[model samples]
Target: MDRKLNRELVKATALRSGYSFTKLAQEVSVSTESVSKWMSGETNPRPGKAIKLGKVLGLSYEQMFGVRDRTLEPQVAFRLVRNQDPSEEHHERAREMGRMYEDLVPFLPFNQFEAPPRLKSPTADYEYLDELCGSLRREMGLEADVPVSLPSIFNHLSDKLQAVVIPVFWGHRKNKAELAAHIYSRKTKTTWIPFNLDTKLWDARFWAAHELAHVYTFDVLDDEAGEIFSDAFAGTLVFPVPIARAAYEELAKVRLKTQKFNLIVEFAKRMHVSPICVAKQVDRYAVAKKQPPVNAEYDGIYAAISRMSKREKTVAEEFFGGEEPSVGQLLEAAANIFKSPFFDTLSKYLKTNGGSPSFIQGLLDCSLVDAKALNSELA
Candidate 1:
């Protein structure tokens, strides 16, 4: 075998198996230096060691020997659009989630799964998008001007589009850039939207709609303009133009800043959107109608909403009648794919050969505890 191909195979297997060179060496009973040489093209594993390597990494001898099969790779290709530049760790985490979803497909109890046909144009303007949203609402059996039921919309998208809507719980409160991400696999025609859960129901709902917009316009929009269009689309989908016009008319009559702030809150609650969204949409509507924007007094409105004595239930809880689903639960479900023969073989090999929990954690981008829990589940 060509040393270059050997190096590529080693590197690719390590990534797919979630093992570092040292860890790979430990699993295969080879020295770290030997594994490094194999990966660097300075040496190749002996036949006996190569077989062990394949077993531990869940690859066939042909795969390790460079007889590559395209089918063995992730069947789905994903495009990720984040609000800001993500850290390397964040990227790895997202990629791990994608891989898990791909592995779960064959095990999921469903058939004839396919993503909805892309219905958006890259060159679509606001008018085109407006008509698109209205049409989509009608297709989904929703009224043109009614406030969208966020949970109902989620369930509908999940079923109709064959997409997974997973809520990601980021424990850090200050990380604002990592809002939501949309990942799609062209090969499998699958889409997954992992949204941030550490936000108000209204904000999370907007983010969900924003990601849905990305799914519709994935190939068309790749820059700042695409982002702007997605935001507009999300706002429109949540609060349609007719509803926005009526809210604008009513909000325009208020003169006092405090009064306006209160009114904006009420409008947001009624429409199931954030007050900030209502304020911005009201401004957009005013510009369209050639009227002055409402005096929303943004800061005061946020402060007042925050200072409210009664806490409203989140949209997820309200709709589902319980706590929002957690990322751990999703991962747990994905881990069931291990019951398949390939993953079962890997699990048996690890158990018999004393595989480290870190190997599973690294491969799945999960916690040590989670890795252990998954191992027990697989057992």
Candidate 2:
């Protein structure tokens, strides 16, 4: 390959790896100047150094030279708050997971489906956003006002939208609150949304809706406003305007502010959403209805809910009989795809090399013992 092409590939891989040039240079046993030159297309590494660099970036020698192999390229969209900063490690891990998904896709049973058209503008009106969600719900044969079933939504997305909804256990625990991610591959025309399973069921469902909003409107929104729009769209999708208004009105009838706490809990349970989400939705409903805001009282209600000792298990847990699906479930869902000779060859290679356990552990974020168990299960 030409020096310029090699440079571009190196830069792309480095960005995906979330590694600085100096750090990558140290890993490859090259000087910072040499790495800079390689990136700038002024110099090319020796064959031995190039091989080492490829290994560090998890790329094959051909891939390092800008050759197009069968690997998939995934574009990731994170659903994080504006103020939060994701560490480089987080970025790299996300990319790594994307690559893993890419490898698994060819084995999965995927249908070709197109996502909804992107909104023309990032600041689409609330009514328009609401209509979008309603349209989607109707398309999926769901009632606009009813609480959505998570598993049902997952199946619809997988079957009709050609999207995969997977619960990932790999992200940083501290960032679990804001760790939803959507990965879209233009080449494969598929989408993957992974929610952090560590969160409450209500929050997980909300995050799922948020990621779906992104999938529907990603091309139209600017980076900053996309998050805001997706948040609004998700809340509206999970709790429609009419339902939210009725909920707020019911709570408003409670004469004492303190008495409304129980009503809030009941409303949340009925809506299948967290109390915090209900509180925020109530605020939004109030704003839309031109009613006086109940911010202070809702804060108190939230605090009271937090003080409770035991909380109810999420709807998902109850529906699944307290057994949450894991990476094994995902693999099983794509079982037919893995029956290919490629996987058979790879499995044999790993087993012969005694690398099966470590590979499984790393890929699924399991401990060594768990990985060994998984290997046995697969065998």
Best by lDDT: 2
lDDT of 2 by residue, 17-94 (tens): 898999998999889998998888776665456767878988776676655443555566775543377543444345
Clashing pairs in 2: 107-337
- Model 1 lDDT, residue 374, Cα: 53
Q: Name the 10 consecutive residues with the lowest summed lDDT in model 2.
A: 337-346
**Native-referenced Cα lDDT, model 2:** 0.63
- What's the CA error at residue 46 for candidate 2, in Å? 24
* RMSD in Å for all candidates: 10.0, 8.9
Off by over 4 Å in 2: 1-73, 79-84, 112-124, 170-179, 314-362
Candidate 1, which segments miss by more than 4 Å at Cα? Answer: 1-85, 108-115, 122-124, 172-177, 295-366, 370-379
lDDT at 316 for candidate 1? 40
Task: Give the per-residue lDDT digits (tens) of candidate 1, residues 30-56.
Answer: 899989888877766644466678778
Q: Model 2 — TM-score against the truth?
A: 0.66
lDDT of each: 0.61, 0.63
* Model 1, residue pairs in steric clash: 77-185
TM-scores across all candidates?
0.62, 0.66
